[model samples]
Target: MAKRRALISVSDKTGIVDFARELAGLGVEIISTGGTASLLEREGIPVIGISDVTGFPEILDGRVKTLHPAVHSGLLAIRDNEEHRRTMEELGLGYIDFVIVNLYPFQQTIAKPDVGYEEAVENIDIGGPTMLRSAAKNHAFVTVVVDAADYAGVLQEIKEGGDTTLETRKRLAAKVFRHTAAYDALIGDYLSQQAGEQLPERFTVTYEKIQDLRYGENPHQRAAFYRKPLAGKGDLTTAEQLHGKELSYNNINDANAALAIVKEFDEPAVVAVKHMNPCGVGIGTTVAEAYRKAYESDPTSIFGGIVAANRTVDAETAGMLSELFLEIVLAPDFTPEALGILTRKKNIRLLKLGDWSRAAERKPEWLVTSVAGGMLVQESDVLSVEASELKVVTDRQPTEEELKQLLFGWKVVKHVKSNAIVLAKDNMTIGVGAGQMNRVGAARIAVEQAGDKARGAVLASDAFFPMGDTVELAAKAGITAIIQPGGSIRDEESIAAANANGIAMVFTGVRHFKH
Candidate 1:
């Protein structure tokens, strides 16, 4: 039998030298290209240059090196076929038993600050993917390796026997295809961004696995956490877990909701989230005051909820937080005394933010939700409304104090699920009704929750009131001011109800519908 031959070409040189050395010791001839060949020869590992095997010098700046029939036929030739052997003899092609390759650093190149288009374009590997696919397609007869972590396993198998097992080759080939697909997707997404295309013909995104959760939303379901390859600073994935048990699926989801709500306020803020909905939100001069107000918003719902604070946690705030049975507490930082107090609870998760300002300022370009067959993608809702942009639509205009409360309520209501109603007073949410089927039902729930607190509080609706019943309900609850998008055809009825009840109403002209 002819001596076995292996081709080794890679952009990531991790563990390649040792693997190649072992292959040479096992009597497998090593063929390499470009920098990989030079590095191996320098490391005292015997190497046969790819040009020496193909009899063709690498041309076009090394882009056209491995695109020849010599490389493909060597990788693709059927070992057990007589016709394939005859063709290989006719064309002087040698059978390649192993193909080791990893693609160029396109992802790292694009992630650099102010990277030029030419540099990014140059990093896209052409011959690498072609060689990988050809070798992987013949995995029944060829062994392919794309990840450096798999190098040890392949080497061990080769040491035990003469070549890798068929099962190992099949698994490695699947990994190679997945790696190449993700690489191409990243390049596609970068090019689409450069072309300023909002929605491309074929949209693709890639994420790297962060962890495998114990379970999903339920105990029986399976789940894993993944983050974008190029996540920005201060994202939820950037949070450092200082204490507590492994994060559950619900914990991460609820904590993310709380973080999104806390970022809406410039002042010291606290948001308590339960089951992906905000139970209470408060902004105050100090974090302690914010936590107190948030706790007072809904003491019952905040028992096992996740709390996110915009400012650092001091001893005083930590003392108050320790009084409750909370699931998670997230803040920009924590004092030593505060950590000492919170660490006593073994089940509570403590996460420190990377950068508070960056978290507040950064906005996601797209929000995706997966459905049964496909996903729905839309631009993230980052709208900020000022007092000057509001149009008073009632005879009794809102006073200055009412305007501040109205704007605060508007920001809080935007994060709530659709059919949402928020009653806020003094920059604190007094009552919140989310995900109701009808606007009036949502309003009634908020009013009932607030009770006497609803008298002077301002009401903010996610969408325009379809009828005057919601206005009447608010009037009965003594809601002083109302803020809504005001695009309903029955706008006159609502305005009349507001005017007759001496309630102030304003139209933002922008609806915030979060479903």
Candidate 2:
């Protein structure tokens, strides 16, 4: 077997010294760069600096160090190619069998509230990713290690087998590419955000495998779990759960939508979500009343749905909730009797999201999706619109009672699928239209559900109207005022429709489309 040569250069020297020492013990040569070499020298382990082997000093503000052909040609040159061997021999470039690197903390730097734009820009690494891609590209001959957490496992495998197996090498290389991809995305996003560009028109993200789920959306499909950014942040992932079944894909999605809506209310609130859309919502004097009103709002759609509540669940509320067939129920807390009552449903998911109002934890966790041959990532939909943030835009201002219902309608609308319409009054949703193919169809469903009560109720929309039809429907249904994101090209038509009917309208400057 050929002797293994590992090149280790990391901005984060978390476990570099120990890792280098372990490589030395395994008879592997350690080649590193800049601080890594200095650190290993201090640790009394022999580490060759890139300059020593490449015979070129690190110049151009340390940017010219690893960019040399000496490093990359060594990493990329095919080991089995006779012509490649001749070229390497002529230039005297050694093959790199392993590459260990981690990029600068650009994500962490930008996340700091006080960090300046210049500081965030400088934290973007150049040479680290170059070496990582080179090693990762030649996975057949090289093992790329970007995570310090993988160091111990790599060392164990090398010590046992005298070298990393090809399977391990490929897996490690896949991780290296993922690491560098995520690093570049964070930098790209930071620069674009700082420049106030139009969200870069497109966003890309890469994530690491954080876990493997029991199964994907279904047991038939294999699945794994990954985490995006927020490595050191105490996000919702860190929250405590009281009990329930292992969350399924649909359960998590609908639970998040339910939680977002429920958190919008300061008073006791209950929201039920089905197919990632809010099917029922209610706010009341007590948690029990809230749940009961929410269930009554659309009991037909609430079956097998995920439920979220703003207030701690009491025994009375739990008893009422347990009577139904819910997939999940989440609240800030559960009274002893409530937990006892709820735990009887072994397959139900229960979550505890305490005191989100305080934001005592870090920034919210993000949700990411994978598309064909690519992926998409975005911050969790956690923006809470306080009553103070609302802008009453109509000539006829909403009454204090109407404003309260407007906010409640706003929360429920945010959790519904796009083209949504919610008719709500008296702190309970009277009717909701979710996932309709067209906005007018959604309005019809909402009005139909509200029936005669539609007259005097408030309405909210996930997106603005393309025309005046939805506004006319809401006005005909007796909606007091309508709330929407309000950036439509036909804004005047919708506004005129609302004004013509003597209905009030407000602009929230935010759109909530669950789909």
User: Whole-model lDDT, candidate 1?
Assistant: 0.92
Q: What RMSD value applies to candidate 2?
A: 5.4
Please write out the lDDT profile of model 2 over residues 262-366, one tens digit for every residue.
766778889988887777888889989998889988889999998888888999999998998998888878889999999998888778766564362224544
Taking all chains together, the TM-score of candidate 1 against the true structure is: 0.96
User: Cα deviation of 293 in candidate 2 (Å)?
Assistant: 3.4
Question: For model 1, how does the per-residue alpha-carbon lDDT over 1-515 read when each residue is reduced to its tens digit?
Answer: 89988899999999999999999999999999999999999999999999988899999888888888899999998888999999999988898888999989999999998999999999999999999999999999999999999999999998898788999999999999988999999999998889998888777988888999999999999999998888776678888999999999999999988998899888899999999889999889999999999999999999999999989999999999999899999999899999999999998999998665644364657778999999988988888789999999999989999999999999899999989999999889999999999999999999999999999999999999999999999999999999999999999999999999999999999999988
Clashing pairs in 2: none
- In order, the Cα lDDT scores of the candidates are 0.92, 0.82
